[model samples]
Target chain A: MSDKTSRRTPGPVYVGLDMGSSRSKVVVIDEAGKLLGHAVKKSGTDFSRTAKACLDSALEMAGAEFDDIAGAMSTGYGRSNVGFVTEESKTEIGCLAKGGYHHFPEAITIIDIGGQDNKIIKLDAAGHRLNFKMNRKCAAGTGAFLEEMSARLDVSLEEMNHLARDAREMIKLGSYCTVFSATEVLESIRNGKNVNDIVKGIFYSMIRRVLEMDSLTERVVMTGGVVAHNAYLVEMVDEMIGRPVLLAEYPQLMGAVGAALYARDENQSAGATTAQASSKGE
Target chain B: MAAGKSTTRKKIQATDLMNQVMSDYFYHLNEAATSGKQKVAWCTSVGPAELLRALGFAVHFPENHAAMLGATRMSTELIPEANSAGYSPDICSYLTADIGAWMKNITPLSKAYPGIESVPKPDVLVYNTNQCRDVQDWFSWYSKELGVPAIGISSPKNVVEVTEGHIDDVARQIEALIPTLEAISGNKLDMQRLRETVTLSRECSELWKKVLETATATPAPLTFFDGTIHMGPAVCLRGTQEAIDYYRVLLAELQGRVEAGVAAVDDESLRIYWEGMPVWGRLRQNSDLFAGLRTSVLASTYCSSWIFPSFDADNPIRSMAKAYLELFIVRSDAYKERYIKGMLEKYRIDGIIYHDAKTCPYNSNSRYGLPQRVEADTGIPCLVLSGDLNDLRCVSDEQTKTNIEAFVEQLQERQ
Candidate 1:
């Protein structure tokens, strides 16, 4: 909101704020692209609440105050209102592509799994972001879907991931959507297949769909809230694609990181411009 | 407009007056049929049977004829029949009355048409449901009553896409029905008749498709509603030579205009893609509104059914049932995705009009996320049109017209 570009103190940090459909995440990254702090809160975006509760919880965890932040970046479902800087918001695709680049410098493919949609972004080997594809316009093959299946199987999220990781044989899970996958998981249960293996098959099926979309995928990296919680997903994805995936240390915080980086750039420019004008006037 | 409003202002009540009148008329006609009700014909929607008669059939539309007699005017007089038939509050009022009338063989109006007894009964029931699916069951019910297997023709379901494979399959299914027709009607369908029917259906369909394609032209030469109703004969009388004829006439008129470079919606700028089921009850009204705004619906998933609805010309008889079953709506969502993508590409749809029908769940699946995908894929702005697929109460003309006006304005500006 400030027009004056003033130099920031050495300890000043920029923060990225992301409000997803299912949860909210934030990250503080200082200059030099080093992540300083990150935090998340499970909260629904009841717009009237203005995300005040989620923000407070995140700030307390990061030990960062409102003033210490020179500027803040925002992205995700609620990026338009993150209130850190006046910069216009980028699309989810743009944010994800930037996140993928920052996380894996050589990454050519980005797989973002969320509650309602599966997006497989394909980038040329040089990381120019060639093309991308999504699922059948449903919230299947996303993390929220996995949570629903895990509930139907009566398995904890941790167990769901572990079981999928341990499975040797993958059955064909009909689809990645909660509607169909739950039914297929139920069918597999009736067929006397072990619960964990069914879960494994589901994870594999999702990875396969992502792989199908990212047909030209090489060095795939995944980001989302589901990644940190479902350790098995990272492992199974590696097995499914026959390669290791570099998970974001804070998988859910990439959007936040991108936002913070944007905020940092804006803050530095503002400060330099203010200094130049002051010196000229003197 | 007054005539239309006054005509529709008949009894809002649910009674059997119209049905009784219809039955009494039908009964006397049946009684008069010394030649055994020769040349019976059934109709699809509520409209004139001129097309059928133009093609040579003793035509009758139960709904239209019932609507014409004005028995819906004194519906309360037949309350006894309405209650006895268990046509309670929940069902569509017209359907209840229609069935109530069909079940009985006496009505006060039967006496009105004094010479009706001399009129012959329908020997063949030609039921078409291109506008509404309810006619399928209605005509089937009548076929049972007449103790004759009615020849009912159905149009394909509307999905976002239709494929050549789908067309081939449907043709095969239609081809396979010939023996079944021989068994049911005891009249073998000649290959010549079948060929004629397919050729007619295809030409008419192609003309209709051309009409749709021409909307891409600046100042579209024809409006969508005109096609919606004109497309009636083609869908209902698919196996007949007349449907082909009617469309051929309509096609020539359209082609002449196109040659002269007439615009359906002159100064065409706004383009839209209809999503979900079409509200048949309000079909013409809505299409007319689009035409008024110079916003042509370049493509609609609903209209796309005919795009890939024919069967493989060769070996068409073996897979008839499978073809009917493979109708995009009945198939998996994978097929639906394929169907929609094709429409987006072929029609170059600028935005989606998601009609969200009240009576149809199949067409309204995953509707919420459709705007996101459509806008992302085709870069087309999309809005979910809130209304039923057929029911009129769910249709708010004022609200609909307002939203459409806004959509067209934004779409044009963006273009």
Candidate 2:
């Protein structure tokens, strides 16, 4: 049988759960580091319930049973709420860095614009984290800011993205605060500004907020749900920074994939230690 | 599957002695306020306690009282009151909280010690701008409200080196204060008494420095949180035998812990240097957080501010000026970088956490690209925590915990 076919009849699988503020995500991977399946859903108020549901969906898609999980790790804002995780929970920053490095495998800065916070993590060529910074105690440049702005502009998030892409001219926003920007958005509407231009302006404001947080490295990788939905933002970043930025294949599931990678490595290390112990005893 | 363990670090035995020392200090201040037997002089914490003591005035530090208000979780509510009274929220929270407590006619003192109705009424107010210009403004407001004489030494700031000229200027200012202090205390300035008080302060400072130096030991026996509480006597009772005696006991206890190889935090693998003012209200929370992470914050700029090594009893005036001007808060960025690098080597620090306190810009060192510079120079990682000395509103406990955990993970990755 082929290795892929053999893996499909899985004896064991590793799992990673990212319990974020807005959405919960889970990824299942086999011994060979091949992604088997993944699932994402709204986090809502009950994190524990949402985490369990995501895990169940991911496992179902992977064609694996509960007994097949060899190891599991949790991460994100609600990481501690995931009761099924078998190892110590990791921070979203470390997980995102690991996930981004797994794809790029180069010196790069990872800009993760998440639901509640934005993180800029710089890594060396050896996959070592050189430095990192998170947004200060504010939601000015995060996914929540976009969501709030969408509601204020009376447009669906997807429509906002489309409008931003089709804009003839970008309308620049003056306020960095979400509340203040909402007032500015109303004024733009009163001035009979094009909705498409205003939406592009909101995108410009969000990009400006993240860019101003820290200087970007030569190789920048953009990830998270914000980038997953708003592909136009990558183009905007390219135009602003005068360089192209890489996008993760599975942006929203990067943290979950990173957690799975950790679980796989840890389980292998434990197995190797046990094997060495057994040989010494013999 | 399971939650992480909570911090279970053993409390230092010296804490009990610190409590007794602080209670007695407040009791004396209460006596001065109520009985009017002694004139009460409100001085800044880093201001000249020796001068006031020599002039026969009972010294009370409003900064210390403001710290108490923060520790007791009263500052957050009181800060807004000061803001409503036309004081901007961006000024020092210590100033706002103290002035607000005054406006509300309440003091944590009354709750801590029996028969203490309020803070001691100041007969005169004195300040030094070595720490920040805020102290003068903080003291001036009270001086106006109470209709008392206000005087201050306008020391030069961002001092790279405390030159002879700087010492001369500050010394002349301090000497000029003798007339007003003498007028308030109804006593002549006795040079002999001033020398004796300066001698006592020097002795107390040396003992405090030695106590802090004990943290150089691997798996430090005491953390910065311990020093913050135990520093009460050094701040309030300096220039008195009480502070000297208290430090001797505290130092003995710490030395015993070092001999026994007892660590303040269990499995203490990471030694961190805290580069700014503490989140005063969350001392216990922050302490437990670091301990739970197996990280010991062994040294800090805020706690080390009281260790005036240049104090000379022989040349009291000049030495006091040099010592106060040499404070970490008053130093330029270049000087601060060198000092922090020395501290990193001294403490064997694995990381640096700079608190960017919202209100106290003078003490917040992270805003000026210092963290990146320090990290690049030392090749040791640095994390900046956003917090305030007195305002809990400026702090986010969840965010702080996440950032610290990630920073620790990065340090571990380096290892």
Query: Each prediction's interface RMSD?
Result: 15.5, 3.0
- List, for all models, the DockQ compared with the true complex: 0.02, 0.48
Q: Write the per-residue lDDT of candidate 2 for residues A1-282, one digit (tens) a residue.
A: 111222245768999998898889999889886788788999999988998898887887787888899989899888888775564688888899888888889999999999999999999999999888988888888999999999988999888778999999978989888999989999999999999999999999999999998989859999899999988988999999999989877899899998888888889999999999999995
What is candidate 1's lDDT per residue for B1-415, written digit by digit as tens? 0001111111112113323434553554455354543344565442213223333344455544433222323223332354476644234334444555555554334465554532244555554443446566666666776776666545455533546665565445444434544443445555444444344544555655665566555555554444444444444444445555555555666666677886555455666667776655565566666655656765665554543244333423323233344555555555666667777666666666776654455567445465556556766666666665434545566446534654554454355
How far residue A60's Cα lies from its native spot in candidate 1, in Å, is 6.6
**lDDT to native, each model:** 0.56, 0.89
Give per-residue CA lDDT, model 1, range A105-131, as digits (tens).
775677877655566665554444444
True contacts kept of each: 0.00, 0.41
Using DockQ as the measure, the top candidate is: 2
What lDDT score goes with residue A51 in model 1? 47
Off by over 4 Å in 1: A1-18, A27-38, A45-50, A57-91, A101-107, A124-132, A137-140, A152-154, A163-202, A205-216, A255-282, B1-51, B55-142, B145-149, B152-415
Quote model 1's iRMS.
Answer: 15.5
Worst 10 residues of 2 chain B by lDDT: B1-10
Residue A16 of candidate 1: its Cα lDDT?
69
